[model samples]
Target: MEISSQIPWSTIAAVISWYSSNIGVLLLNKYLLTNYGFAYPVFLTLCHMTACSVLSYIAVSVMDVVPFQSIQSRTQLVKICGLSVVFCFSVVCGNISLKYIPVSFNQAIGATTPFFTAVFAYLVSRKREAWITYGTLVPVVAGVIIATGGEPSFHLFGFLICVSATAARAFKSVLQGILLSSEGEKLNSMNLLMYMAPIAMVVLLPAAILMEDKVIWITIEIARNDIRVVWLLLFSSSLAFFVNLTNFLVTKHTSPLTLQVLGNAKGAVAVGVSILVFKNPVSVVGMMGYGLTVIGVILYTETKKRYRL
Candidate 1:
């Protein structure tokens, strides 16, 4: 399919915007991790959802585009709920993984999502992918293995959680792609997010209540004492909105494999920042692994051109 024709200037702009937003999110997440601790994901989700819901309501009220009463549809509702669950799982695992690993390492490993997504898509959709696509998987896997450095003492549970988060993200991408492709031309970024953010917020609420406990109350105390926490949460929420919108746009504009390449770059950027800003240590083995992973991504991208895979 000629995806370019499907994605107009607005979509391209959204993609760029989303990319910028993701970078901002990375920086914000790093700072928040250093200051507010890892539980920030729960708080971040809560604030983002609350803010989006309020903004959406205001937009609906002012524009009166579709009557609030008339906006309910079973299919849309279902899709929203599905997307929400996927988002929650992805974020929870991802957030937790950060507590155990540096952002850069997490991103490098996460870049393997395209390979996983392809594997999952082939199994679930029964689509026949080009053999070259399968070939590309070699370097992707190699890169991840190299980046991980086979550290015997590494946190196994944390690594597993991060991998699960990556898989969840990949699944979400494939599902969203299917949804967009089948839903006609009206499935724009804002529309998808409008439905997704609220549902995700709803899903997160109970999880936060159950997990946060007195820590939930503590976030308030922290926010009051350190105003930066509040700002971080607000920034994190905005970043979430931007990242979700851009990610969907990228999927719509380019192939899933291309998105994976971007993911690789994002991981590198995060790692670079973590090392510089947070002084996170990068061991020699970890550096070697990162090199292999990047090289694998390059090889995979180059291969995709000749094979349409």
Candidate 2:
């Protein structure tokens, strides 16, 4: 009873929410892009941003879920817009990779995010981790290399794009931390997402139009023929909002490093689900590599936690 009383139920709930939303969006995305033949990654990402913009407004302004925050200055608005660009790039590349790679392989690559986060932290904030922490990243890199060599359906283009997306994600995380670290500049997760979503729409619009061409009309036609596509898109967009919201909540309740550790575990879960659902071919080497990455991430997290003490 005493141990139960000490448990942080709220934080645990937030983490579960984050995992469900993250995995749902990811798997749905893979289904839409690969199996469903919706190959327009940019347009799909644009749809996601549009959903986020509308849903975020409804939640904040209409439902009063969280307190609304207004942009205080031009500088702050610019920073939000800048962050939106990176966010858009990260999301689009991630979606594109789904078209070419299995989700299990993608998750294996994603487990390396902590390594990129460490590098970006130093480059952006001049913050350095302990030597032991840096050493733990060694296996993270080795694991990805092994996973890459063992990927049955490895596409170089896909691998490169996935890696870029991972790096961009880390950079965005670090940049957000630094850019909004100030008390005056800080906006709660919901508000930050609320502001960034519309900006992301603006950024994604032209890219979708130029690169994807008439894919939007194709998506509409498909939706008209099959209502399931519409339902899928709607569900995916809603999940995306929850992903961002729960991500912020988790980080708020715990810490960013905790988020990273949870994320690594989330990657393992995603890998298992992807293999089960998609039946993607996997080799023993690939699984071993992914296991190594997970272990490295755990060590890295522990090292950071102990160093802080």
Pick by lDDT: which candidate is best? Answer: 2
lDDT of 2 by residue, 1-309 (tens): 764487588988998899999999999999999999888889889889998999889988999878898888999999999899998999999999999999998888888888999999998778998888899999999999998888898999999999999999999989999888888899887898899999999888889999987887888899889989989888888898889888877988887776777887899999998899999899999899889988988998889888852
- Model 2 poorest ten-residue lDDT run: 1-10
The C-alpha stretches of model 2 lying farther than 4 A from their native spots are 1-12, 252-258
Compared to the true structure, candidate 2 yields what TM-score?
Answer: 0.94
The C-alpha TM-scores of every prediction are 0.79, 0.94
Sliding window of 10 residues with minimal summed lDDT for model 1: 64-73
lDDT of 1 by residue, 1-101 (tens): 68778767776686567667886776676566654464556656677777666555554456653334322467656765786689778877877777677
* Residue 85 lDDT in candidate 2: 95
Clashes of each: 3, 0
Model 2 clash tally, residue pairs: 0
